[model samples]
Target: MGLITPIGFFSIVQKPSDRTHDTLTVRARMRGDLAALK
Candidate 1:
């Protein structure tokens, strides 16, 4: 039960972190494209 609890918590934490990382990467890419266009 203890091990499973940590695993579940980690899985929940990982999802949002992954999403934020992807959003930041996409924003960075868009900014780079705009800069290149200029």
Candidate 2:
């Protein structure tokens, strides 16, 4: 069906986005800690 391609693409795209989102969150937290330390 036509819907299958988007579903497959979204699954692939979502994983990396989740990883990047997690990495960004961790970096932000580290930056906050650094600011607090200063």
Could you tally the backbone clashes for each prediction? 0, 0
**Across residues 1-38, which tens digit of lDDT does each residue of candidate 2 receive?**
11223213111133566786664222223344435434
Using all chains and alpha carbons, the TM-scores for the candidates as numbered come to 0.23, 0.23
Could you give me the TM-score of model 2 versus the true structure? Answer: 0.23
Measured with C-alpha atoms, the lDDT of residue 30 in candidate 1 is 39
**Which ten-residue region of model 2 has the weakest summed lDDT?**
1-10
| Alpha-carbon shift of residue 9 in model 2 (angstroms) | 38
